[model samples]
Target: MEKTKVFTLVFKTLFFLLIALFFSWGIWNGYFSMIFTESERFLLLLQQHLLLVVTSSLMAVAVAIPLGIFVTRPRFAKSEWFVLNTANLGQTIPVIAILAIVMTYLGIGFNTAVFALFVFSLLPILRNTVAGLNSVDPAMKDAAKGMGLTPMQTLWRIEMPNAMFTIMAGVRTAIVMNIGTAALASLVGGGGLGDLIFAGINLRDNAYLFSGAVPVTLLALTVDGLLRLSERIFIPKGLQEAAKSA
Candidate 1:
């Protein structure tokens, strides 16, 4: 590889290493122990938090992508605004309100919290997907159709590839939001980092609160970074370069 490429790789590696080291130093001094005590289930809470976020984000992607695609069709073109507005309306409600409503009907548990988080995570993705697909060059779409590609083939090969970065942006937003919102799950008997923070609040312990909050923040950052990496990997090289330049 060229010297410039080698230097860039080394720099990126060290940057991440520094972050790992920072966390390691904090852990070494018992900074993390404040949350992880002899009997405390810190790891379990962390696991639950991650599970909720991942599951809810995945569910949102599954629904939002298809829904976004469906609404952009000619048959649904006139109703697109109505459907998107409905999704926008969902976002207007407070997440806690949505959670409570679901809890009331669905009962308190992991599943209910997931449902609420899924609702909260939907708008960004749905809006971005529609916008992304719509933003595709109409001429390119026509060209695709003229080349004997079926509608679905044109969408899959031309539209989605061109729109991938935008779609991934939506996915990234939802994932981060999902992570933060998943903390609320604890309020409804859904175990997660939020339980720790709430427990610390009740007990007036800063350590416990930071323990939960810090990890959640870090988790969000890590996930966001991973998504960016995934986007770079999946995005067309020319588009990636264009994005970087822009």
Candidate 2:
């Protein structure tokens, strides 16, 4: 098992190295010259994209986790179906359509984009939170109660810790998806990497297309990597081992 783990690690390292080299080659060959030629503009768009993703994702996490917790509670259990379905409705709608509806109300720009993305990001995190909490071993909760721990104590000490892995997984998924979706913000004059991509399409410029496309891809990968690292650092060791075993 240890050898297998090492092999997997080495394989992933080499895979990312190859991808890095490919991007480096493309940059060196001026395949992404627009990124350098309009460095200021590119930077601005990149910043806007990052801001949209971060703000929207944070909003989703802030709302969805607590809402998920609320709906999962015994008192609110009957409402879970309604809540899940409502969130699911957001997912069922096309993102572009959602953006259009949001634009109708919010007009346009960063706020509209953030709201739309937040809606898009809610379901995965909410669903995962509920599922994660539900999956916590009943025995553990019972034990916590048996030890005279209060309901809140059981949740904080026993349930939350165990549920964290799945919760983080949901967060990672939402953030990565948000990174890609934020590109669409440019459509509403919100400004993002999509500006370059769409411009490239209109003008038939590969450089512009690659300039935007590459960065978005890289951002998603980087965020996912960071989140994975955070999971390793933050999640309990026993939980990690249990996950591995499972």
Candidate 3:
């Protein structure tokens, strides 16, 4: 354990050092000059990008979690295939195509982007939720019933805790994907770092391209890291130890 901790510390230190070095190189090469030259606009686009990610992710969570839970219930077991396939269909469709369809109906804007993103982000989370719950031990559920616990009690106390790590894994996947997809929102005038990215492409400007690409990459990494930390904090300690052992 001590060796593990030490290795982790060393790894983190090296990681941060590499990030610092990369940014310093970017500064030297003027790759990030747009941030300084067009600070206000850059900031605005960044804010819009974050808003797009947060709003859509939250919406996905709200809809997906319940839908996932619903389809997992024994009463709805027969419908699970249909629901999963529907979500899978949404995911299988190209995100750009989804955006285009949404744009056709909504006529483009932040709301249009959010709706499209919400659709795109739903499947992973819903699938994970169902899988996590389904993976819970039947013996455990039986034991809870023998103890006279109500169905709801068993679900909340015995099931959800065990399933949380998997569900959160899905959420992390969805959110990280959403962050990257949000960049495409610029194509529809949804207003985000995509504006910079597409602009750079059209104008053949490296600075504009890197400005958008770097931030999107960093944001995804940062959010994924935070979600991992949250999983560590929120997942039951016994499960964490069990996971490590596994």
Highest TM-score against the true fold, candidate: 3
Q: Write the per-residue lDDT of candidate 3 for residues 134-191, one digit (tens) a residue.
A: 9999999999999999988998898889999999999999999999999999988999
Candidate 2 residues lying further than 4 Å off, grouped into runs, are 1-25
Expressed as tens digits, the lDDT of each residue in 1-246 for candidate 1 is 699999999999999999899778767866567664733588888889988998888899999999999999878898789989999999999989999899989999999999999999999999999999999999999999998999999889889989988899999998998898888899999999998789779988766776888899989999999998898787888888887899
Alpha-carbon lDDT, every model = 0.89, 0.92, 0.95
Q: Is candidate 2 or candidate 3 better by TM-score?
A: 3
The positional error of residue 133 in candidate 3, measured at the CA in angstroms, is 0.3
- Worst ten-residue run, lDDT, model 1? 31-40
How high is the lDDT of residue 112 in model 3?
A: 89
In Å, residue 148's CA in model 1 sits off its true spot by 1.6
Give per-model TM-scores: 0.86, 0.90, 0.91
Error of 3 at 124 (Å): 0.6
Q: What tens digits encode model 2's per-residue C-alpha lDDT throughout 1-246?
A: 999999999999999999999889887878788877889999999998988998999999999999989998888999999999999999999888989999999998888899999999999999999999999989988889999998899888888889999999999999999999888888888899999988888898878889999999999999999999999876899989987999
lDDT of 1 at 235: 80
* Ranked by lDDT, top first: 3, 2, 1
Error of 2 at 89 (Å): 1.0
TM-score of 1: 0.86
- TM-score order of candidates, top first: 3, 2, 1
